[model samples]
Target: MTTELDLGSIRHAPKVLLHDHLDGGLRPDTVLELAERAGYRELPADEPVALADWFRTAAHSGSLERYLQPFAHTVAVMQTAEALHRVAYECVRDLAADAVVYAEVRFAPELHLAAGLTLPQVVEAVLAGFAAGQQDAAAAGTPIVVRTLVTAMRHAARSLDIAELAIDYRDRGVCGFDIAGAEAGHPPTRHLDAFEHIREYNGHSTIHAGEAFGLPSIHEALAFCGADRLGHGVRIVDDITEAADGGQRLGRLAALVRDNRVPLELCPSSNVQTGAVPSFAEHPFDLLARLRFRVTVNTDNRLMSDTSMSREMLRLVETFGYGWADLQRFTINAMKSAFYPFDQRLALIDDVIKPRYAVLIGG
Candidate 1:
């Protein structure tokens, strides 16, 4: 008989993460040290544990605007090359330890420019750090492939520049381009030039839509901006309804999303913290999953949520009674949706994910 899956067993299974943010997952102690090194002392708490508590508590305010307030501290401390490098390195170390076999961590290059570093400089620093972290993780027997997704702030005008930057570094550790920030006023179509540029170059992009906004945001992201995926697409549920027969019915937009196999990067805990969903039970994740939407689990902000891949998966198992097979399906879904090259993604799925999951499922 299959053993009951818990946090320990979940961590042992290989996972793929596609929607994590680089600046949103800093270690508390790292934040403190970076702040001290940079001489930016605006932290709410001095102690590491207290600082961690502050971030978690602060992010639980149930407003997307309030949920984003804690990023100021993390961004303040991650200005210099050394600080960015250290945080990137530690991010890989932490994710590897959590048994995430592959991850695409994104950050806005424009946010790191306050330290006078150029966009390329910031991207280079993060890519170099990821490379070093991969080497270290491989040497330590917990091998992981960490790639970068260069993000442009949705409220900013430099999206085209960031898109070009992502394309320039595509052969490097950078895998794709993304746009993140508040989603209410700054619609994805506002960055039409950038999305067009990425498309012209045959590049990949994921837009932060359907999180803080409704169907229009998701519709524009898919139809106008041509996002390859939707980040925090919990609001896609808005376009779905229960029919009189008690079966879930998909609206026109939802039908298109499902028909196209568009992946929804759902972060359960972060969704609750941001008030995207009333709670985990109310989250559209299980509904989307049951309806066969290409739903993948993610920890949008590990630090803010006090979560890891194992913790996210374990929560699903606890709340939805997801077994090993379900977890494996999510992992494979993420792998399939990754912006990485097709050959590499296939190799990881065939050689790594499937075999490991087969063993875990006792096949």
Candidate 2:
């Protein structure tokens, strides 16, 4: 095995990201420019550096609602089709620079309809942007592939509409469907009809569960709504307990998740900032990884958490002593759990992920 990795080395390592929100990952300067172009006048700060800090501070306000308050500004600037295209293009470009070979970025189309653009227009704009970004990344020699996950806000009632939209564009660029928003009063079961429609079309889904809420939400997402993956399922640790002699006990729900090998899109920094867990040292990621659950590292919101895939992996490496082998395992796990086809996933692991790690580990 190779020695412990550092941030500079980690940044050069190939990565796969599965859980990033579009509205939550914009560059600070891009947000300022978009707001200015759209004549949005309520920005908390005019400068990019201050606006970036404002997002992080607002998200660290110790409440989920407070954490989400900054999105209103980001979404406000992303209403027009041109703005959507630029935001998506910049997302792929940034990820490529970070050495992310594969990613699935998510966004709620319904949220971008305020400026008279139809649902189809929003998806097409983002897809076109992804295409342009992918081409540019290829030309720059950091080639990356990106897919979209059409999301519907759970607090709203447009899940079925979004689910159908996801299927409509599945062959174009959309790869899956998801439900996001406040989870306290809005459970996954409330959108059972949407999940059912996706299942009927044999489509894939990941639900935001067990983050702000408890295990009941997770149960409904998996057993009830049939989610293929869990978004921010960090709270699954609630079902696991340590015994007197350091042995651990897994409750039924935890056992089921582990047994099924259900993918948990765990966002470390975002979880801490949103108060999903107490701190990084007490984060359940290490525990879940040791238990051999299908845990994947992710950046739920890059802007809010001020993170990238490299930063997230660096934090875990420092906290858990993860080496090159551990980093490779996490990358492969994310590739396997991707909504992309199995043949494509296998090719990436064999041709890209493995080869890249082999170089880093000095094979």
Candidate 3:
């Protein structure tokens, strides 16, 4: 019989992460040092541990705006190419340490232009960092491959430019395009031009929708924008209902999402921090998973949420008593949903992910 999995075993399992932010996953000490180096004095705390605590406390304010406040400092320090490269490099190191075999780290290039670095320079620096980190990880006997997702801030107007940037860098390290920011007033429809541009190029796009807003935002993202995936599509749950006879009914949107296999990049901890759900137990992940809604767990903001893929999986294991099979399923879901090419994704699933899980499950 398979034994209960511990944090150690979970950490050893090969994992795939699809929706992590480069600006949101910096090491606390790295942020502090970078801020000091860049003369950015707006950070709430000078010390690493205190700064980390401040970020976690501030992000839990139950408002997406409040949760996003820390990015000002992170983005401030990340304006320089050196800072961007270091942050992306450390992100790979951290994820590899967590046994993440593959990840797609995203950040908006427009936000990193405060230092006057060209957008291509910013992308090049980050790609170089990921390459360096991957090489280092391989040398250290824990190999990891990281790709980039070029995100355009939803509140900003540079999305079409950013889409072109993603397309330009597709063969480099960039894998996909995304628009992430507050989803309330800034709908994905506002970036329809960018979405259309990506579609024209036959590129992949994941829209940040249905998190701060509800079904309407999700509707525009899927029905209008044709998102390949939904970033933090947690609020898609709002379209689902339970009947008096204890049967669950999915509204048109939810049914379409499920039937079409649109991946929901559900970041449970980040969702709770952003007030998307009351708490873990109240989260719709289990419901969506039970209904087979192409659910995949993620760490949207590692620093702010004080989380990693392993911790996210462990929390689910503790809360829902998930087994090795459940964990493997989530890993495979994320791997399958990755914007990576189909043949390579399948190769990772069969050659890397499955063998690791089989060893853990004693199969």
Candidate 4:
């Protein structure tokens, strides 16, 4: 409530995160320790600080494929149930420390099967970790609610299986299903059965489109797959044009997206690291926000981008001069778009987000 709008001040403001990756947000020290305990010796750097630096540097290669290369080590160590639980617990603790009141963390269960853990075991382990973390955070007076999004690798054919697994644990802690990985060749259309299954069961889903791919991918996700949200839908900018009089124009697909209020889970720093945009200044987040798209800020990968919800909001505040009101709007947008039940989402917004922002904005 100081009107300073710095990192410390922003961290005190209640925030909602919609697109954090579980495996991608591990603590450097935890990764080193896990690797040592698991006898995994493929680490590029043995030291925690150096390993963290390596991830940031390597992710800056500006190619989506190259940016994803660092996940090999993270996923390698997370093969065991203990490793997965520890990582999940630490993810919630870190986000709670950053003042993220609600977050939907995603990870591919198929990736964690390397150590002979079944899909249900992987989901349960992460969910158990989240529950324990939430209890600890509440006891520490910085409460947070962390939900899981079961992800299917786009290149793999297990999307249907993953979708079922998500639905099976929907009542527990898993909130939704997702399809991720390189978006170029593996179109969301390829997983039509998985999306259709979720829809048949009345489940929620978000597709990883418009990041490394283009309009066709998005078109398929919405028109065909019926995605509830767009994961990194920054490339929707391509469908927006400028008129001769310096006005903005929205194409049919863009109009469809905007008119329907489809949420765009935008991760500014991760977008730049993955070469989705040249830099933060050129990101379409501001444009989409101004256009009234249901835009919500996120941290796609905390370890790779070294970002948190506060850092993401601070970037927008510094670049676009967003005030407390703006940040609150983004936070509310995320809460509304969350896969949580309507009543729970409304309760959090009314009781937590709005009240906290009122204090900051009024001060």
lDDT string for model 2 (1-363, tens) is 564489998999999999999999999999999998999999999999999999998898766777888999999999998999999999999999999999999999999999999999999999999999999999999999999999999999999999999999999999999999889999988899999999999999999999989999999999989999999899899999997889999999999999999999999898898889999988999999999999999999999999999999999999999989899999999999999999999999999999889988983
lDDT of 1 at 30: 91
lDDT of 4: 0.94
Candidate 3 accuracy as lDDT = 0.92
| TM-score (C-alpha, index-matched) for candidate 3 | 0.98
* Local lDDT at 106 for model 3: 93
Which ranges in model 1 have alpha carbons more than 4 Å from their true place? Answer: none
The 0-to-1 C-alpha lDDT of every candidate, in the order given, reads 0.93, 0.94, 0.92, 0.94
Q: Once model 4 is optimally superposed onto the true structure by TM-score, how far is the C-alpha of residue 85 displaced, in angstroms? A: 0.7
lDDT of 3 by residue, 149-219 (tens): 99999999999999999999999989989999888899889999999999999999998888889999999
Measured against the true structure, the TM-scores of the candidates, in listed sequence, are 0.99, 0.98, 0.98, 0.99
| Sliding window of 10 residues with minimal summed lDDT for model 2 | 1-10
What is the per-residue lDDT of model 1 for residues 41-151, given as tens digits with 9 covering 90 to 100? 799999899999999999998889999999999999989898889999999999999999999999999999997999999999999999999999999999999999999
The clash tally of candidate 2 reads 0
Q: For residue 107, what is the lDDT in candidate 1?
A: 95
Residue 215 deviation, candidate 2, in Å?
0.2
Q: Candidate 4, after superposition: displacement of residue 191 in Å?
A: 0.6
